[model samples]
Structures are given as structure tokens and as C-alpha cells.
Target: MRFPFFKQERRVEERPRDFRVISPRIIDILTHLKVQAEKLKRTYHRLLARDKELFEACVRAEQELDRDRATIYANEIAQLRKMSRTILKSQISLEKVIL
Candidate 1:
């Protein structure tokens, strides 16, 4: 004989899932993340441009045989490179989250 408990269980299992309730929030979050990644990329490019300018200055200082000025520019370039590396890591991490 058929059982009432089994009929109720089958009905519950057959109900369709509605993703419409959850998709918008996910889309918004991903869109925000993509924007952040783009911003980081722009910042990285700016840093690279600055680094190039500094390197040129440093080389000029060295050619002039000016020890003090060349040393200062070299130190500044090192700091800028370190900062650029950190920004790149952060951008990669955000992209991973978006994926």
C-alpha cells in the first residue's frame, strides 16, 4: 500500500530551485571586484612610469660622477619597485576572487 509520508517527501524533492533571488547580489559584488582590479592595474602602470623616470635620473647622476645624488636616486628606485610588487600581488589576489 502507498504511504502518506513517502508522497510528501517526493513533493518536497521535486520543487524547482529559484536562483533569481541570489544572482543579483553576486553580480553586484563581482562587478565591484572587477572595478577594483582595474584601478590596481592603473596604479601599477603609473608606478612603472615613475620608476622609469627615476632610473633615468639615477643614470644621469652616475654619469656626472656624483656619488651622493646617485645613491639617493638608487634608494628611491628600490623603494618604488618594492611598492609596485606589493600592488601586483594584491591585484592578482582580487582577480582570483572574481574568478
Candidate 2:
């Protein structure tokens, strides 16, 4: 069924890709990745120092927590001792007389 309505077989032109330098966006992305890689490599070499700092920080935090815990325990013990002393003082003993 040929109606000859639409144009038959349009001719398309094939163009060759122009070889040019790298685009600025691509260059910037590559440079950024390169810098990031260098930073990662440097950090990898400093793992021991990083670990030591983390350990020292954890130790300091644990010591502070222990000091706070000790203070709380001491306060509770002092309160209990005061209550015991008060109870002992308030107790009355009846005198016993036997003939």
C-alpha cells in the first residue's frame, strides 16, 4: 500500500567526531579525584597516630566517667551512714529491774 504521502527515504549525513583536548569539567573531576586519592594515601600512612589519638581520647573519657561514678557512690554511702547514725541515736532502751 503506497500512498506517496510522506517523504520516502530522507538522506542523513554522517559526520566524523572532532578530536579535541579534554573538557574542563572532565579535567576538574580528574584533578579532584587525584587530590582525594593523595589524601587517602596520606591518611593510610597515619593510621597508627590516628589510633593512638582515639585511644587517648577514650581513656580520658573513661577516667572522667569513673570519677563521676565514684563521686555518686561516695555521696550515697555518706547519706546511708548518716541515716544509720540517726536511727541508732533515736532508739530507746527500757531499763530492766529484777529483785
Candidate 3:
């Protein structure tokens, strides 16, 4: 009285997943990432040192520029004083000649 369509089919057995195959590959990737991270950290520190050195150089250059500007201004002032003295001596001689 039962039909074949009413009977349950047998289920296929699934194989257990093997993590050993994937675990080593993941470990290798993690190890590579760690090595790369260390290298990047070293590079960043080197860059920082270079930046500090450049800043110090800029400070030295600025100091030199200030000294040069002061020297130029002092020379110009001396020249102006000499010119003023010459004019006063000429004026005094002219007054004596007229009198």
C-alpha cells in the first residue's frame, strides 16, 4: 500500500574539514606581515631622524642670514657718516673764504 516516492533517500556522508592545510598558509602570511611591519617602523624612525637634522640645518642657516644682514647695515651706516663729515668740512671752508 506504500508508494516508492514516500520512502526517504539515504543522505551522503560529509567529509570532516581539514584545518591543517590552511593553518600553515595563514601562519606564513602572518609572519610575513610581522616582518614587513618591523621594516616599516625602522624606516619611519629613520625618516624622523632625517627630519630633525634638516630642521637643525635650517636654524643654522637662519642665524647666518641674520649675521650677514647686520654686517651690511653697519657698513652702510659707516658710509653715510663719512659722507656727512665731508659735507660739514666743505661748508666750513666756504664760510671762511667768503668772510
Which candidate has the highest lDDT of all? 1
Deviation from native of the Cα of residue 64 in model 2, angstroms: 26
Please provide, for model 2 over 1-99, each residue's C-alpha lDDT reduced to its tens digit, 9 standing for 90 to 100: 656896687798987766476689877876766665555445544543554554555556557887665555555555545554543333311111100
Q: Where does model 1 exceed 4 Å of error?
A: 1-22
Compared with the true structure, the alpha-carbon lDDT of candidate 2 equals 0.52
RMSD of each: 5.2, 31.0, 33.0
Per-residue lDDT of candidate 1, residues 2-99 (tens digit):
78677554454565777566687898998999999999999999999999999999999999999899999999999999999999999999999988
When sorted by lDDT, best at the front, the candidate numbers are 1, 3, 2
lDDT of each residue in 1-99, candidate 3, tens digit only: 768789776899998998666687777876766665555455545545554554555556557786665555555545545554554565455444433
Error of 3 at 65 (Å): 0.7
Off by over 4 Å in 2: 1-20, 48-99
Model 3 weakest 10-residue run by lDDT: 90-99
Query: RMSD in Å for candidate 3, one decimal?
Result: 33.0
